[model samples]
Target: MNYRTILITALSCALVACQQTPTKPHAPNNLVTQAPALGAPVAVYTTAKNTEQRLSQGTTLTFAKSVQPSEGEISVFVNPHKSFQTFIGVGGAFTDASAEVFAKLPQDKQQELLTAYYDKEQGIGYSLARTTIHSSDFGSHSFTYIEEGDKELKTFSIDHDREFRLPLIKQAIDAAGGELLVYASPWSPPAFMKSNNNMLKGGKLLPEYFESWAMYYTKFIKAYEAEGIPIWGITIQNEPMAVQRWESNIYTAEEERDFLKNYLGPIMEREGLGDKNIVVWDHNRDLISQRANTIFEDPEAAKYAWGIGFHWYETWAGGTTMHDNLYNVAQSFPDKKLLFTEGTNERFSRDKYQHWPNAERYGHSMINDFNAGTVGWTDWNILLDENGGPNHVQNFCFSPIHADTRTGELIYTPSYYYIGHFSKFIAPGAKRISTTVSRSHLLATSFQNDDGKTATVVMNQSDDDIAYNFIVEDKEVELTIPARAMQTLVY
Candidate 1:
């Protein structure tokens, strides 16, 4: 069900509490506890009103031997034995625009932000990152690697990105301990490759330029590798169905299938880069299944595609719900992978700038998407200015972190904390384990990482507090979650 369909009701604290501080040491009357283990379940919580707690680490919840799982209270049951999709990671795009503004900050501040995003011990380590093939809507201007009409690509250059993005990527790789898996996406083909002969608006890539454009992908991959920043994967095009005023190109499902089967896929194999992922349909959920089916049904095309990617815009736009489309794709292509490629709230509303609801959207979507079978999730822009720009098309959007390039000050929005509740604890290669919530309002997802640790994140979007027992392995840990808050328990 969509977020709007869920009925939100108030949950009373007395239902789950016995007159104790939420975070202080308190043993529920009936449960027996032993001495605390080195790695007991710890909770980190964030409240909506910016009250109570704000992504603060709370007291550890002790494991009990003999308490019957509360039947009347809401329950979150986690089953690591029944694991599912392996998680790739979570992160945001490293646009040239983001790097340009980031470069404006003092060197110390720049490193601070980088370390905050990529250092596992210091911050929420982001393992996956997206970068524009040339210039996306976030760039200062439209650009391409190849010079005008250079189909042979003798004059191709990534110099434009080297000025800002490449260096920042290298720094981020260092901060991440080289764990970053970078993926590249193109917003539009060069002006010469499109029938409209312009990159600023929707156009069609001429069939004649198919091979040239396919070669362009390899050139970009090789060039970035030369810079010490390997391109792990690439989407054929960004928002392939949209006709936007910004850098965009339209590719019908049939067109995309033919291009990949005949040109892109064959070339990658020929160049011995078959291992690099080729993701299809970098669009929204509204038509995701339809687009995916058209291409994936074609054995020629299906053999080359690593997975299907989608954005959350369709759900926010009141179109198809993200989870439904995700489930559809998962059921139909059980052998393939799924990824949440891009999403961000646009046209920042001052009324909701630091609003917890904005952050709630991220948690809500991520939980649902993960449950629906997405391996990785990537947000739109990693960083944006206070004005939400550097965007050439004037399409301003909110980011997890906003900075004052002029003052060198940074503002961490609730989105950052919400994402941290997941990305920080759930490491790459983690498997999404089965989780069931007794109350619909208590939206949650659980995972078991390769390290053998498990994390369960529960979010309460309702107006009341919830008293619930998190049950696993026949042991139970009782916890109370505040209304309009999220809690992550890592054990």
Candidate 2:
């Protein structure tokens, strides 16, 4: 839970590329440059400053030579970032924005901004997005494909979706430069199956309706396929361990295991829906052991699920666990893919109000996650209202950008710039390379493209300048890093 505090403080950007640097520690004075603000005067380095500080583009970016590659190796492809959990995708309040906000914008302007956001990945990168099947913690209230208790499940339909979600989602997908990774998850079950009789409060699917729920997932896959959106994987539940005050369900490990093995597994297979991937434990990192045990106990459940999903809610870090505890699942369940399903530093809680330095966040997360064998990485709320959203749910965090709900306005958040610092450049097929770090506060990661190009990312969390050396391929470079900054170097 304190992760939000740590993460929020790391990326409280109000801003990518190669923000990489050297790995050794030195002094702070070396990395200092005449930095420029978002819209500030461009600096002109005099010949004297350039001679003394080795400045370029008016910035003092220095390099220090290394004696040897940090210490070990992190090969990008040979030991690729492995994860069985395929992405369910991520987007937010934006689906509703068309009616509430985008409708007010001129058609040309709407098309332009939409293209910029959803299309950037098409040029050389990739984008996999997620959305709720209906209402979610970020939506107005609890809802499903249809009103509840209509037996025989004949009325089960996503017809209402065509008017809202499908259109907006389709628009974004088409805008993406390449094929989009599309998946859907539910925040709650149809109200009928709940004990409280409302999706707003948590409920357990009364065992009798198990088959119906399985069919529900299949129907969604079939429906999306009909609309040209293929459902790649269906996460059994979103945040299984979270019993929130909004649309949610409470499913214990035993319940999920039984449901996946006995109900969902057989039903989907019988329905010839076996090609789709089944994932479990769409919860936080702390619950990895719980998920591991449940999947391990029920051999049948383990057989059906390709992998598991986790969030960054709790800080599972300790000095002795091979790296932090976040790596334990990958360390223990090496064969099962680990997908980080849903995460956001600013979940709109009063606790989210603060400044998290940008360098430590996106850079650090991408480092740890890929290192932990996470193949699919996504954030919550692709877009939100300027004030975070027209969210009745209040706890809605956001993506890199937010389109105003009342007016056609766009506001880019730090998270957007942060994600772009990575996603906009690293394509899906790209591999993370091996790396080693010797300094405590100096964090690092590396990647290798299929064509043999090299990319290394490093972040210096200390408040002072540091000197370091980095060796890529066979060339060694010396670097001097400044305090309060992060860097990425690619060759």
TM-scores for all candidates: the values are: 0.90, 0.76
Clashes of each: 0, 39
407: Cα error in model 1, Å: 1.0
lDDT for every model?
0.80, 0.56
Question: Model 2 over residues 363-410: C-alpha lDDT tens digits?
Answer: 466667766656667676655555665465676654455565556666
Model 2, position 487: C-alpha lDDT score: 50
Models, CA RMSD each: 9.0, 10.1
TM-score of 2: 0.76
Give me the runs in candidate 2 sitting further than 4 Å from their true place. Answer: 1-109, 120-126, 315-323, 347-354, 480-482
Candidate 1 structure quality by residue, lDDT tens digits, 16-47: 00111111011112222222243366554444
